[model samples]
Target: MFKQMVIILMTSVLVNNYVLNKFLGICPFLGVSKKLKQAAGMSVAVIFVQVMATAATWPIYTFLLVPNNLKYLETIVFILVIAALVQFVEMALKKFIPSLYKSLGVYLPLITTNCAVLGVCLNNISDGYGFAESLVSALGCGLGFMLAMVLFAGVRGRMESSDVPKAFRGLPITLIAASIVSLSFYGFRGIIDNLFK
Candidate 1:
C-alpha cells in the first residue's frame, strides 16, 4: 500500500507528467504561458479543480459506477464532476478570492475542458487506485502541470527578448523548448520504477 501510494505520487509528478509526458494540456501551455503571473494563476486554478474533481469522482466510480457494473459511464461521470467542480471553484474564487478570479478570468472556464484534468481522472481509474491514492495522484499531477507551465512561462518570457530565426520565432521555438523539457523529465522514469518496486 505504501509503495502504491509512492508510485502514484511519483508517476503523476514526474514520470508520467501531464505536460511533458502525456502532452495533455498543451493548449494552455502555449496560450497562457506568456506571463508568469497568468501561468501561476492558471496553475492554482487547475490544482483546485483537479483535486476537487478527483475527490468527487473517485467515490462515484468506486461506490456507484463500479458496483453497478456501469463502468461505461466512467467517462461521462468524470466529465460532469470536473465541469461542476470547475464551475463551483470559479464562483467561490470570485466571491472570496476576487483577485485570483480576476487573474484566472476566462481561463477558469477553460479548466473544464482541460485534457489534463480528464486525463488524470482516467489514469487514476485505469490504475485501479483507491480514493486516497487517486486524490494524491490528482494533486501531484496538478502540481506537475503547474511546475511545467511556470517553467515554460519563465523561459518564454526570456525568449520574448531573445533573438531567433524568423521561421522559428513563435510556435516552432516553443515546441522545440517543450521537447527539451520533455526529454529532461524522462529522467524521472527511474524514480517511478524504484518507487513502484
Candidate 2:
C-alpha cells in the first residue's frame, strides 16, 4: 500500500501533471502565474479544494452513488462538490487574505469550474483508488500544479525584463513559455515506472 501510494503520488506530481502535462486548469495557470505571490496563493487554494473535494467525493461515490446505481450522476455531483469547496475557499481568502483574494479576482471563483479540480475527483473514482489513495492523488496533483505555477512565474519574471521581438511579445511569448514548460515535464514520463522497478 505504501509503495502504491508513493507511485500514485510521484506519477501525479511529476509524470501526469494536470497543468504541464495533462493541460488542465489553464485559466488560472496563465492568469495567476504572472506573480509568484499570486501564483502561490492560487496554488494553495487549488490544493485545498482538490484534497477536500476528494475527501468528500470518494465516500459519496463509493458508499452512496455506486451502491444506489447513481453512478451516472457523478459529473453533476462532483461539480456541486467542487463548486461548494471553491466558494468556501473564496470566502476564507476574502476574510483572511484580502490581498490574495483581490489578486485572484475571477480566477478564484473560476476554480469552481476548473477542469483540474473536477478532473482529480473524477479520476480518483475512475482509477478505482481507495479513499486514502484518492487523497494522496489529489495532494500530488495539487503539488504538481504548484510546481508548474511557481516555475512559470519565475520564467515570466525573466521574460518581463528581456527585450523581445514585437511579434513574440505579450500573450504570444507567454504561451510559448508555457509550451516549453509543458515540454520539460515530458522528461518525467517514465521515471515512476523505472524507479518502482
C-alpha lDDT of all candidate models, in order? 0.87, 0.90
Q: Which lDDT tens digits does candidate 2 get at residues 2-117?
A: 99999999999999999988889898898889999889888987887889999999999999999999999999999998788778878888899889778664566768878899
Q: What residue runs in model 2 are displaced by over 4 Å at the alpha carbon?
A: 91-107
Q: How many residue pairs clash in each candidate?
A: 0, 0
lDDT of 1 by residue, 103-175 (tens): 7767889888899999888988898878888899999899999999988898888888999999999899999
Best by lDDT: 2
lDDT of 2: 0.90
Residue pairs with backbone overlap in model 1: none
Q: What ranges in model 1 sit over 4 Å off?
A: 1-4, 193-197
TM-score of each: 0.91, 0.90
lDDT of 1: 0.87
* Range of the 10 consecutive residues with the lowest summed lDDT in candidate 2: 101-110
- Model 2 steric clash pairs: none
